[model samples]
Target: MQITQKIPPFLERNLGNVLIIAFLAILYIPILLYWYDGWLNKSINIEHEYFSHALIGFPYATYLIFGKNRHQWQKLPNKNHPLGGFLLALGLAFYITGSAELVAISFPIIITGVMLWLKGMPGLRLNGFPLLLILLATPNSIPYLLTPYTLPLQKFIAAMAGFLLQQLRVNSQVDGIYLYVNNIPVEVAPYCAGLKMLFTSLYVSLLLLHWTGKISDRGRVITLLSGALIISTLANIIRNTLLAVFHGNGQHKAFEILHDGWGGDIYSTGMLIVIIGLNWSLDRFEESSMIISDEKDDNFNE
Candidate 1:
């Protein structure tokens, strides 16, 4: 008699999913780790820290895919189609080229292909918010694209900070992107032009519009996005003002802590909290206006 083995029922049932997951892990894990290294330890400029915002993207995407939305993912239909096969094939071809840039480019194509192949075209098109999140989170050469604008912003920050310092009775002057605080020249380098903070805030604002269902309200979305941009700009101006005061007035240690240590993180976290508070305030204001409008309509109907 031939020897036989029994497969665990659960394992047998989920074998396809397991295989797909394993294949993805092998294909994507290296790339993901590479990105992780860049985000945390190897920014293009240690001072600018632009790529660090990508650090927020992965965790948030995971939560979107498998947290409260887990059931939605579970309900998707699994199907096999040639379009999916073509995408997968294309993504794989790109991956094997041994070019990091090409691999980065292929990342979303692979995600789309996988979604279509596993969940059908309808699922890919209709229930694809998670895909958009992943795409947004994917770090790119955006910092490079934004480089030219940094000088103008740097000038703005220096001027604004100089004004704030004068209000505080501190003698400050701005020359282009350089601020003379206590007659000590402090340059507002492009690296510390707050590009990362501004970029991250804009991104997080878009995510908020989607998460809070504010995207459906086009006017409110525009207002909120504009608010986010303004808040980021103001926050950066304040941060640089403080830094100018600290560094120009012989508080070098304090300036270093704020610029290169946990102080910076605390300030950034505070900025994000403020943005969230803005979102909450807008929501409450909108609800109150709706309530008043409904009351007016009721009186009209009477």
Candidate 2:
């Protein structure tokens, strides 16, 4: 009789990765349970799910960018093996919640899991762990490390907006995080911090890079992201100033209504407008550079 040997591949060799993932998975259950309790206790709201909820957009984004290129989502051997077990375990847990919202919310996670099992691409794999941790982590958390950058951006915007108002001789003063104008004070709350727009603009910039295929280098990506961050911060400053101006003119109640309720939607729409304009500007700059490059090459050949 002959004995046959079996071997695991490179991904399996990264046992540390697997162990870290497993540890994260183990941590997620307690986190989710706590978050569920908070939700039941009303300490958290739907907006708290913003970080987790945006994940639903990820699949759509991937589809938009990579669907046309069949090889983009390359499949690896045994990718689907763990998927069945995952669904069986998670599906049963969700069935207990029995809320339409929970089910609807979990649906994206389910699709994300299925897609990952079907394709083991690098970006998708990285996205999977974070999504899974967040799905499992209670309160569907955002990391604290991200807060520093967000806070600074918000303060900077508030300052800039206040300066612009002052420049217009509209009587505005920036006191720490508060913007006082015409005897009305608007606190630069965490919500107005421009974090959402910063992230959204960055995501859009990445999408733009993919579409144009003209700036794939790491340095270029960083430059584009830096531009996005700066532009987003400035745009938010302008937005805050506009809101303050409106509020100063006895539109306080109306602005508050929009700010607390539909503020993100409004800001997002405005950010999209500004980002589109910036994109057009960047396109023109790139075209001019290309023209110059072509002329230089022609002269060199001469």
- Please provide, for model 1 over 1-302, each residue's C-alpha lDDT reduced to its tens digit, 9 standing for 90 to 100: 99999989988976876787788888889878767775665443443246466677666766766575657656767676678889989988988997765687678778788777877877576547667767766656677677787898899899889999989989888899998888998888876798778877877887788779887788978888888889998999999999999988999998988887778888988888888889999999989999999999999999
Candidate 1, residue 74: the lDDT equals 63
Model 2, span 210-279: residue lDDT tens: 5566444676578677888887878778778888887877886768765654664666667766665666
**Alpha-carbon deviation at 65 in model 2, angstroms:** 8.8
TM-score of 2: 0.61
lDDT scores of the candidates, listed in order: 0.79, 0.61
RMSD of every candidate to native, in Å, equals 2.9, 10.3
Worst 10 residues of 1 by lDDT: 42-51
Cα deviation of 232, candidate 2, in Å: 1.3
Model 2: lDDT to the true structure: 0.61
Best by lDDT: 1
Tell me how far candidate 1 lies from the true structure as C-alpha RMSD in angstroms. 2.9
